[model samples]
Target: MARIAVIGAGMGAMAAAARLAVAGHRVVVYERGETYGGAVRRFERDGFSFDTGPGLLTLPAVYRDLFVKTGKQPLEECVDLVQVDPSSRHVFPDGTEVALPNASRAGVVQALEAALGAGVGDRWGDFLVRAREAWDRTRRPLLEEPLWTDWQVLAEREPYPAVPHKRLLRTRRAGTLAEIAAWELRDPRLTALLDSHALAYGLDPRDVPASAAVLPYMEHAFGTWYVRGGIRELARAVYERCVARRVEFVFGAEVTRIVEKDGWAAGLELADGTVTEADHVVAGVDPGRLRGLTKHALDEDGDVFPDASAPSPGRFTVLLALRGAREAEAAHRTVVHTPDRGAELNWVSGEGPGPVRPTVTVLRPDDPALRPDEEHESVVLTATARPKGDWAADGSSKPFVEMMVHEAGAAIPGLRERILWQETRTPGHNGDETGAFCGGMPAPSLAGGKGYFLRPSNSTRLPGLYRVGGWSHPGGGLPHAGMSGALVAGLIVEGPGFRGSQ
Candidate 1:
């Protein structure tokens, strides 16, 4: 069995470690922080707890498969997986509100029709049909399999089947998501609904490829989920699973370098000046951090190593502790759509300072574990922001936080008055805690623009080096990060000829 060295104890890295250990390989995970989860962290004060990372899980089957493969109990047995009903509630700029049902196409259609108009629901339903086509065409390549050597094929081809539209004498299909919204959905609320999916991942909807439609499709198809305590509970379960499988972990053991022997990865050098040799090395951190450890320039193909100049978007979160219990009828998640989409988009994409009113996602889970008792509640508000800029120094996020709380007033009555205390998490905090570059949060891989959605490949120029994580192949999000782990383990245990998970 090969001795494998994994960098970081993030979800992706631990997933790979668990699988490799089950395959009979000796795996050791080294993390700089004291905890196992990377960004999937939680904060607790005076019996109030909050999940600082992703609040919900989509495509939980990814983790379910991991648990089934690595241990006897399934994911549900490890953690309480609850389906969040009314998947989400959207508040539109025009004072229109729609509560979409979880994983039900007919229900979503009915809700949209009841709130918007007669033809609006049908238009969205048709768009979902087309989005399904995109998902079918790209799922295997983008998620189920490792990136191809001729990845240029994916980049050159657009998987989304844009609807044929006739404009006078010309028949044109949408190339960008904005074009699809303008040409197909015709309503401003529908446009905001469509663009919100892309914006949540930090992609500029105006320029992102039409394949991004699959983003919403994935959510609607798989449904959203929540763990009993918080998402941090899921991370704890995975970490425990790795331990059960004999995967060793060393916390506060920061890696300083990736030693190479004759152009192959030899081992890792730790911050304490200890060198641990291994037969293969798997890196699960950001591309920039990986490069720093190796001290080598990555291949120029740009498939495995993305452009460093364009940092991925980071999250700005506000955690609130409230004095009252959550209402029984409240939806688990609420999206407050901004009135001016253009200004929000421009600011998030780094083109502007962001508008006074920005789109905000408010999460209020009814789980009693997050608060001291049923009489209290914990709420989280988050918005997408660029990795750069001084969020703390300029006091920019302060106003945005106020705006978000004001908009969230639609969901929670007397929200400002109900707050017992508040805490804000910025990009800088993310960078420090998770070691992400500029505290950027990577988005999931997409198909279009000659591989614009493609992340760095799993394999690198070095023979024994591999990458597995949100910053690697298949990209970010809880489910995608887990998939990255599976792909990397497959490549290592089954060899380079390994196509993908069965």
Candidate 2:
């Protein structure tokens, strides 16, 4: 059996560790932090708890497969996976509100038409139909298989089949998401609806390719889910699975360098001057951290690293503990749309100080586990922001938090007065906790720009070195991170011929 050394105890690393152990490999995981789960952290105070990371899970089948492959007990047996009905509620700037039913196309269409006016629903339904095409075209190459060496083919080709449009006696096809929203949807609220999905991922919809339609499509197809306590429980389950498979974890072991011997990764050197030897190394941290550990220059065309010129974006969150019980009619998730889309986009893209009124997503779960009692409630407000700058400063996140609370007031009545206490998590805080450069959260892969959608391949130039996690192939998000682990184990155990997980 080959000896494997995995860096970081994040979900992706732990997932790979579990699978590899089941394959009879001796796997050792080294994490710089005391706990596993990476960003899947939870905060508790006065008997209240809140998930500091992703609040919801999409495509849970990914984890289901992980648990099934590793052990006899499936994912459901390990954690309470509940499907959230009425996936989300959208409160537009104009005061129009709509609660979209979970995984129900007809329900979403009917609700949109009722809130936004007649005919809007049909347009949106049509758009979803087109998005399904993009999902089918790229799902195999992007999610089910390893990134191809000739990934340029995937990049140069747009999987979204744009409908033919004729304007001023000329026929043209939409290339970017902005064009699709303007030309096909032809409604301001519809445009906001489409852009919000991309914006949540810190992507500028104006520039993002049309294939991005697949983003919302994935949610509609699979449905959104919530773990019983918080997403942290999901991480706990994966970590436990790893331990059950005999994978050893060394906490507080900061890997300072990747020891190389004969041009292959030999082992890892820790900050405390301890070295652990291994036959293979799987890195599950960000690309910048991986580069720092190896001190090796990556081949320009070989690795799918982020653009050095543009900094990645991170999340800014405000956790609220309120004095009143959650209203029975409250939607589990609500997105308060920004008044000015242009300004918000410009600010997030580094053009200017972000809009004073940024789009905000508020999550308020009904589960009693999050509250001290039925008389109290826990709420989380999240928005996308750049990872660098003064965001983490004392007063930096306060204004944004206040603005978010004001916007969320639309969903939660008497929001300002109901608050017992509030806490803020900035991108800088994320950097401190997770060790990501500038605390940036990577977005899922897309199709365009010469394989720009592809992440760094699982196999690296160093013979025994590989990468897994949100920063690597298939890119970020819970499901993608889990799939990355599966891909890495497949490559390590089954060899390069490992096409992907079945």
Off by over 4 Å in 1: 166-171, 300-305
Measured with C-alpha atoms, the lDDT of residue 470 in candidate 2 is 87
Q: Each candidate: what lDDT?
A: 0.89, 0.88
For model 1, residues 1-502, the per-residue Cα lDDT tens digits are 9999999999999999999999999999989999988899999998999999999999999999999999999999999999999999999988889999999888899999999999999999999999999999999999999998888888878877746656555556678899999989999998988998888888888988888999999999999999999999999999999999999999999899999998889999999999999999999887878878876655554553357556778888889999988899998999999988888888887788654587889999999899999989999998887667467777687887788788888888789889999999887788888888778888888888667778988888888999998988899899999999999999998899999977
Q: Candidate 2 residues 156-246, lDDT tens each?
A: 8988875766665655667789988988899989899899988888888888888889999999999999999999999999999999999
What is the Cα-based lDDT of residue 40 in candidate 1? 96
- Model 1 residue 144 lDDT score: 91
| C-alpha RMSD of candidate 1 | 1.4
CA shift of 211, model 1, Å: 0.5
Lowest-sum lDDT 10-residue window in model 2: 300-309
